[model samples]
Target chain A: MNIFASLSRKPWIWSFVAAFVVWIATILFTGGTSAIGLSQAALTFAAFSILVGIGQMFVITLGPGNIDLCVPATMTLAGTIALKFMQVDNSLILPGLVVAVAIGAVVGMGNFALIKLLQIPPIIATLSMSFIVQSTAIWTNRGLRIKPPQALAKFTTETTIGIPHVALVALVLSVFAFILLQKTVYGRWIAAIGQSNRAARMAGIPVDGTRFVTYILCAVLAAFCGYLLASFSGGAALNMGSEYLLMSIAVVVIGGTAVAGGNSNVAGIWGASLFMFLVVSMLNTYGAGAGIRLIMTGLIIIAVIVAAGGRNPNQR
Target chain B: MKRALPSDSIRLLIPALSLTILLIAVFYLQPRAMSYVGLNLLFNLAVPIALATIAQMLIMTVNDLDLSMGTFVSFVACVAATFLQATPVIGVLILVAAIATYAALGVLIHVRTLPSIVVTLGMSFVWGGLAVLILPAPGGHAPEWARAVMISRPPLVPMAIIACVVIAMVAHFVIMRSSIGVILRGVGGNARSVERAGWSILGARAATYALAAFFAILAGISLVGLTTSADANIALRYTLLSIAGVILGGGEFTGGRVSPIGAVIGALTLTLAGSFLSFLRISPDWQIGAQGAILIVVLGLRLLLNRLENREKRS
Candidate 1:
């Protein structure tokens, strides 16, 4: 096989290509003086997006119409509650992490229950769940800034050998996700279900159980991000997770994950996340106004999808 | 025929029934709202939301979702406030151009086989960015004539009721009764079959998306008219609100099945829930959660009705 053809067949190649081009554009625009700083910032911010993107990828892989609109809210609720619980105490770091993940699990279960039991559409179910979660956050938060535990904050903010700790955490999680998708039967089960729900059921795969687990897993990951984000950023704010809502979905789609479901792109997420951050930074560096920046972002996403996104399965 | 009527009636009646319950609760809590003035004040704010819901329902009728509905509306509102108010011709032209862009989007989506969700999500950002450029700080005057129309009062019924009745009648006639509406829905219900029948899927999609944009524009104009100002983020909440309204009104996500009358009722029900909240004097923090509860209860009722119907069939 031709090298170019084989590389192109891998859906994720376009994202990496785009990221590299954008990275070059930014460095050149800045007179090539701050490549290291730009790369570091891109990696650090991209880490949060990658974490949420991983969770969204799994859920989206479960087929069309499977999405979690509550990711941002789950993050907000988890971060707020965990920070409050820890109350800046260094000794309670482990318990704080557990608390955040637990909150995520509960929210995940509620989101799935709405979809499975109430027969509500996942879009609407997760949306309504987000509402409740957001309200709960507001009720608990009350516009106060509670400091995260000192050790936890230090761990999240500190870098090792010029690599951000948060990025390292995200790297570990990505490896875990890669293994989960490639090496595990559960991964294959979700892909099968996504490709054909009825066929998967007939083949004796547990569709509902797999979907349930996937939803929980996505929420747990979101919650984990929230915990680390609050610690890194100094405290939890009610609106801390708002940007991630779109960022998570955008990176997942732009990274070449199949929107029609059953395809996963773990590596593409990093490429897409880094590309997204760099693109925004580049536009900002060019002194573009918010309006221009947003328009460019939207247009870039559409252009990328048209160029890189394969023919939608539904079309055939 | 008899079997069909029960299921169909159950689907449509539930929305109206919920709206009635909400109205009663609001009136009971604040009896002063039993009067004509109170009624106008109560429902006047829902007109824009009702229009937004109709727009969402129109998109749903074609089996596509418009995540940009709210932002698009906000953009239109900004255009109406700044362009329409300062230079009426420019404003009308801008609105027309925006609607044309919407039609083009439909064509592009069809030809490209792209996911409508991602496309609309991208469009949301574009619209938001444009709106900000037009009015960055959220201060623009709604046209005087539009404000007059919004606040106009006729003899017995309030302007809101009259506007709603007119809206319901027009939407129902265009989408539910007309030949074009039938084809639009047919495209959604079975695109392949519609294509086989010599109708252009692209045309049908373009028409539906354009009509949805038209309604969203109406929503934005009415919103600015009522508030007498325009802001970029003014209608941000309407995206979710419109989605919930469509669902509450018995519109399914993937089907061509949608009811214009039900959508209006659903919008009214949501607006009333806010009124009921104030009457109950709940903390402002839980107000958003109450809206979620209303969504759950409405959906839960449908589930219960389905179970009951199944039990009756078995028995």
Candidate 2:
């Protein structure tokens, strides 16, 4: 009964337990110091996914089949734009971040417009937008390599109390996200909209407005993640942002947020992101090739999704 | 008022109109494109895309999205390049097993009441992994017979154009003009109703998924044939392109309303657009963006037309 109660209260328990087991195994095989290094690396990278998962959590909570598929493209475009604008000067960092944010907001608006004005499905609408964004990124850059500024790179990579600075930022963001979702009226409105749009509209919950805002916010988060990743890597590549697209969705769903909406798991997202990262790290520790890792990740995603689908909110 | 074109005709009209516009643009940009040789070159890569689009259309007809179509095709290509070249019987068995897996996927989706998007998205990774494991890199030869068939040319027309016509006609007849087609579409339109009408919903879904797999298999084999090589990453773009093609061809996400004819034409339009941009000497980087822009503009126009039609009806 105690176990059941805990599981009910914390949907993220499954992921945490899974991650812990994997971490132990990794430590057993790779020694204590290397395990710590893997943990630090995973935690640092998990920050990017946590940011993406938050925005995706909001959108997925918007109702069944409501997803933003343009995240990777948006991130790639943002990174490209940031690299082009940041230059070599340290003073340009703030302006570059602002530019990335603004571009994300605009792209989000475009996604909203496509979904609302044209009544195109969310998946297709975002996908088409992503393609357009990809094109713009590619055409403008042609695979140009511009190193990130010193300040931004330091901000992303530097450690504080053995935790990467970005991880600390992500921690604060997750807390804020948790409070927003669990305590705010706006969060309630989003939850209502997700459960049933028609009912929410009948109850005067401003369904479309909330959904529009959610999509924009998700894009903004993705854009920020792209910027951070570009800085962390010291440069951007054409396909730099591709992996985040699926990773974000996988984190959200595996974090126990119902894919059919009506539920938001802010805390769960943090744990799930860490779990996914650890899975990758563990595979790497075992010297598993990319193909084996790919297969394992795919199988894990399917298994988790299948398990969650059993009690999905959308099912009658 | 007496004769506004029927809605079905209007549905078919859009793709025709867009294809013509694209052809004219291509010809105007490069007069040499009007020749058979030029067209052969322009549309040489379109066959695989058209076949993949048709595969997507089949899945759409059953109200399921196969997000793995692109990677699954690549997996098939890998098998074609390796096993088909070295061991013909093994290659045939592997391809058949892959199709069976697709059929099993449909059953699993139905039984588990799982979202097709998530399931297929996960499967895309699996297929990609398999592809990587099989090829490990970007070098493999297609079977000799497959290469011969792909390279074959006849008088007065490009092989690609002729093949497109034949494939479209065959798909249309099977999926739109036959009894089983009606049943399949019925399953998509209303599964409960189809079940009530004594049709097996699960069976229809399995059949559609199997047919989709079959088409994707063809797409992969032909892709290998054309390129005479296979890579784990080849055909990755087909996932989005096929979905876009289906929608541009007037297919919807909900209902079983898809058009093989329109899908083939949509693929042709997109292929031509890409070739046309290349002919204009635009950077390869911009080619994808240009293709996307065309999809948006065409879909936007279709939406505008829909509004007008609705307004006219009300008046």
Candidate 3:
């Protein structure tokens, strides 16, 4: 009874349960031959989603009116600009990383300024910011597929002790996020703010500063995902970050984070990300047509939410 | 009721101001657009977008949103192009079912307390998939009636402008002046009080969603009429476009605050902004960015107005 209650309280367990079920089902399709390969591949792709997903989760935790719609645009700009700066020079990889995060920080500040200074809704502010960033990316890309440095590409693709390098990098970041959320004062401040902005202010929390930093952290994570993704895929493409917008949100919601805000979990993000990748691959492996695949994906998302999300308070 | 509606006069002025500025810019860039024929060409596409904006406006009225609007419109367009053109009865049935599905979604969101964005995002995939199944490619022809209705040339003014006027008036009467509209907006302002008044929040939500679905269906048919064909992704951007239009028209995200006439003008202004940019010979790549810039500038103006209003209140 105690274990069951604890499990129920941990919203992320559901996503992990779903992910494991999907993984097993996929393995069954291959008659157990593709288990290791499937797991590795799932982990590899899930890493990218996890990277962006962590960022989105933090923003979503800030409450109902808060969300970051510029993840894809930020990713594109960082990847494109960073790769261009590197020019395939291995020595420039550190600079490239700094450039991506710095761009993310700048975008974050801009997004917050629009919301705070101009009083625009976060949705509109991020969306409009995304458009400008997308344009900059287009201008920078100029139809070029600038490749990453030779060593970085090898590092992204190759495994360290049988774990894909990218997945390890994602794991490290995940740990960092977990620490920030659980073991830090910043995490508590954000949760308090999300629960009730007025109450948080009364409690002497620095609401605006915390909110600002959260946006910056989220953007920085997105940029990191872009930089790593560009390196992993051998180059940057203008449309590269597009798929991630939905992926990040899906993992957070499906992973069982409260959509109403004030509560979030790091583990669920990983589980949901893995499940998303596996589900797609499974549907593809089953010879399902694109239409069927999309329909099933949609239905599954609804089912998970209805089953789990219905337990939360009703929010418009 | 007064609180439910924001500063109404100022709200109207902001959208009108932006529209006039964009219109002047477009005229300066391309003198031909000043004429009836040129104006028609520029605004024909805005008609469908205008309808979609109204649909989004209704959802906003109830403080819920529909992210699947684009895919839903795409699905309806596919049905109109293929099935409606081939057999009217089946097409009508499908559209009716789609509208009912939208109503059901509203009830589901309300009953389960599910976030509309997540549920609608899921529905977007389902609708997109169904659209693909209905029209595997972009080759299906639109129904002849739809084509004729869209191409019908009215006298003295362009068909686009006439459609906009009619749509704006109808939406205004239905959403702003009607009893149901009042009650729904009340739900957005304070659902608890509305409930205390013995109104069913569920019913209001369903009605609002159903009405939005009706407008979106019309948008889809009109879009197909213009293109004479349909694809699964035909109106994918309409989701974002509709949301942006609603915001541009002075619709707030959470409040029941929305203006039908303002929304119509907002959609037209967006279409005109695109035309203005293209006439400036801006690269296709930067055109989207320019739209974003325009949105920001207009919103910044809103800030200025807001500050003035605040100062006046204080004084």
Interface RMSD values for all candidates: 1.5, 2.0, 1.5
Ranked by TM-score from best down, the candidates are 1, 3, 2
Chain A (candidate 3) TM-score to true chain A? 0.97
**Model 2 per-residue lDDT tens digits across residues A1-316:** 9978767556676667667777888888876868668878888989999998898899999887688888988888898789789886799998999989988999999999988887777887888888788888887667788888988888899898889988998889889888888899889988888888888999988787888888899999888888888899998788988888878888887787876788788877877888888888888889989888888878877887776667544442
DockQ of 3: 0.68
Q: Can you tell me which runs of candidate 1 are displaced by over 4 Å?
A: A310-316, B1-7, B313-315
Instruction: Give the DockQ-based CAPRI class for model 1.
Output: medium
Write down the DockQ of candidate 2. 0.57
Instruction: Extract clashing residue pairs from model 3.
Output: none
Rate residue B246 of model 3 by lDDT: 86
For model 2, the stretches where C-alpha displacement exceeds 4 angstroms are: A6-11, A31-33, A139-142, A311-316, B3-6
Label model 3 with its docking quality class. medium
Per-residue lDDT over B1-315 for candidate 2, one digit per residue giving the tens place of the 0 to 100 score = 678886767887878888888888889988988998898888888999999999999999988888899899999999999998999999999999999999998988888877787788889999999999999999989999989878899999999999899989999999989998999899889889999999988899898999999999999999999999999999998998898888888888777888888899888888888877787787777777777777777778788888887888999
- For candidate 1, lDDT tens digit of each residue in B1-315? 144465546778889888888898898899999987999999998899999999999888888888888899899999989999999999999999999999998998888878787888889889999999999997999999999999898889999988888888899899889999999889779999999999999999999889999999999999999999999999988988998888988888776988888888889888989989989998999998888888888888878877887787787
Work out how many backbone clashes candidate 3 has: 0
Among the candidates, what TM-score does chain A have in each? 0.97, 0.94, 0.97
Model 2 chain B worst lDDT window (10 residues): B1-10
